[model samples]
Target: MDGFYAAYLTGRAGSGLLLFAIRGPTFIGVDGGGVKYDGQIEVVDVGLKCTIVYMIPAGTPNLITGASPPATDQRIPLEFILPKDFWNGQVVGITTPLGPVNARFQKLRDW
Candidate 1:
């Protein structure tokens, strides 16, 4: 699935809690999920907030897009993205995949 797609937190039954593909040397991972500030909900927190940003290449339709509320057992928030601003780094989605683990990223076009 390319262009505008959605990723749900299927489960925490493995190595890392969040799973995704990104366009960087990083773990294709976002920041906040690994640690928790005092008031900030840690990725392990029950109602954490996660955000994902993707860098889209040119020529993609509906550069900005959103997804339906995940139909899974998790309570992910409604996501928003602006493909134009995302030319260098597009904003993907945001949600608490698990406890305090809020995940977010920018999907870089693979082409």
Candidate 2:
């Protein structure tokens, strides 16, 4: 499973939250469910108002060629999982560096 990430800053820049559009495997539990991705995280765009200079778990590189700073196809190794329990208001999904703590909602994909 794989997806692209976009870093979103609230009012300013530098640091903020991450918006991910992932198409991967889903995890279902008695408590709730989520989407689990394996291997690595790919960077598509930093966002319209932001820019991701670099990421983690190098060696591989970004598939997008001819980037301005030359984006790598590398993958950032982390415990990334998007929980399906948004109403509960629990700190779930995308834990590593930091979870999407400010995620207002999650839109599931057909994957």
Candidate 3:
């Protein structure tokens, strides 16, 4: 199956974009500005949370997760990429530094 899906991380305190390509492991998901052209994202726990690691300026690796060595405020910008095999529908609650945000994952049968 040629999997294709999209997600948006809105309600950001400032302007930012969360974009994922239909194909490939590269994305620049922070709206209205200069973001890195390449990065990798891995979603875990059936979309419950994701550990986003990106290396910008060539050496610095930035990571975002619910809890870890890279703990971060939920208010910070984040993104997700579901695998093609993911089929469960769920509504995820993300607590940001601003407030609570909900993201829904519904399977789209068509393009």
Candidate 4:
């Protein structure tokens, strides 16, 4: 599939979110289970007052659905973090295949 997707982030630490855009082809499991996606996504972080591309490696599992992949892009809130530290900002961008998408972060309130 070729299109645009909006990705974002929320929470922090073990509760962090990795709202990704599912891309590529979809297929059923050998056991005729839920669908699965065979594509990758570009995880962009806007929590550092800047845009950073977080590499999800090449063969990261459980990126799609728990059992079957959705027909369209799904916003999955997975546990995400920046190394040993936590995400200090909000906002995230999601683009698949290729990107240079526009994204921004703003301070809502002081914590």
Q: Which of the numbered candidates is closest to the native, going by highest TM-score?
A: 3
Q: Ranking under lDDT, best-scoring first? A: 3, 2, 1, 4
lDDT of 2 by residue, 4-88 (tens): 3443222211233344544443222110111222332333343111122224232322212212222344333444333333323
lDDT of 3 by residue, 1-111 (tens): 223333333332322334334233333333233233344444456632333433223222222222222233223344454444543445445564334444443344433
TM-scores for all candidates?
0.22, 0.26, 0.34, 0.20
Off by over 4 Å in 3: 6-39, 43-75, 79-87, 107-111
Candidates' C-alpha lDDT:
0.28, 0.31, 0.37, 0.27
Candidate whose lDDT is highest = 3
> Which prediction has more favorable TM-score, 1 or 4?
1
Q: Which stretches of candidate 4 lie over 4 Å from their true place?
A: 1-16, 19-50, 65-93, 98-111
Write the residue-wise lDDT of candidate 4 on 1-111 in tens digits.
222222232221111222223223221111112212232333346321212333333343343222232345443322222221122243344343322222222222222
lDDT of 1 by residue, 1-111 (tens): 123212322223322223343222222332113311111111323332324333322332221122222333222333222233332333333333232222233344452
Candidate 2 global TM-score: 0.26
Report the poorest 10 consecutive residues by lDDT, candidate 1: 35-44
The TM-score of predicted model 1 comes to 0.22
Clashing pairs in 3: 16-31, 17-29, 17-30, 17-31, 74-96, 75-96, 75-97
Clash number by candidate, in order? 17, 6, 7, 4
